[model samples]
Target: MTAVKFLSDEYLDELGDLVTPDLPEVPHVNVRLQFHATDTPEGEVDYHLVAERGVVVRAGRGLLADSDLAIRASYRDLLAFESGELHAATAFVTGQFAVTGDRAKVLDLMVVLQSGNYQRFIADLWARTTW
Candidate 1:
């Protein structure tokens, strides 16, 4: 998975494994990711995550029919966050990360983000990614 392109099909496909196990503590959270990167073929891509009973059963491209939250950000910023170079709070406060939709969902994501599991997952993903 080295030299991976940002938000490419392969990247998005692999996201499910990394993200699913990290949400074991929260089961009712669903979110949509709107990724925008300058070099992407379409300049943007979308993904949705649906976790139930602490497991992610569905995660793929496009928005869910009804989503709990929408987390949007540039490709670089997202990479930075996942790489631990950009703090989530700093990214949000600096406008690098924009979150919308249900507050409860956001809270659940926040919990995951605060946990070491998320950090480990991010690190693993970053390791697999080339840039």
Candidate 2:
């Protein structure tokens, strides 16, 4: 298990393969989320993930059509958010994280991510990911 560059094509491929489409034990909401990271060596990085009941079913690089939510931030900030050093809600309120699209979907996604199953899932991925 070599570490993969965060949000790189290989990383997205690996994440696409690893993410469960649905976690029956955890609450989930149907939504599509887009992540955009700026200020990287590669310029801007874009990825979209489709979730069916809170778990990612499809994750790919580039913009996704009709995403229910789009979240953007500097790569450094995103790194902190991913590592749990930055709380998204607080960051959003502080203007550190920018989010757009359906407000309901944003709230729903938050709920799903806070679930214990999702926490463990994120931890596993974080451990395997390279900064």
Candidate 3:
């Protein structure tokens, strides 16, 4: 399996546009994604995503003191999920992905997976990489 590199800034910028329009009228939540690339020799990468008031900002870090939500999954799973090739719920059920934190907040974030917009985003990204 090839290791995938996800730049926190780029990911957040894309996610911001997709999420802002659908966000509820509530304070922002800080969600940290600790990605463990299983097939890679390099260690884990922490992607910190802060979503609040219709804005999402991502920062690459080694650790976070506070994380309302944490998602643990391989790069391939993330690619499959974002590209709509895999269902997030099904992945969770199958133990391909693990999520920890406030269940409600986690569920709220998961709602985006059902929107189908992420597929288009992933397609665009894949196209760019091919060139």
- TM-score leader: 2
Q: For model 1, where is the 10-residue window of minimal lDDT?
A: 30-39
- Judged by lDDT relative to the true structure, which candidate is superior, 1 or 2? 2
| lDDT, model 2 | 0.77
Tens digits of lDDT, candidate 2, 1-131: 77877777777676666466556633547778898989976679998777676666777788887898898899899888878999878877887878888868877777666767667866777888887
Badly placed stretches (over 4 Å) of model 3 are: 1-34, 59-62, 113-121
lDDT of 3 at 90: 88
Q: Pick the candidate with the highest lDDT.
A: 2
TM-score for each model: 0.73, 0.85, 0.59
Q: Which stretches of candidate 2 lie over 4 Å from their true place?
A: 25-28
At residue 96, what lDDT does model 2 achieve?
82
Query: What are the Cα lDDT values of the candidates?
Result: 0.64, 0.77, 0.52
- Residue clash pairs of candidate 3: 28-52
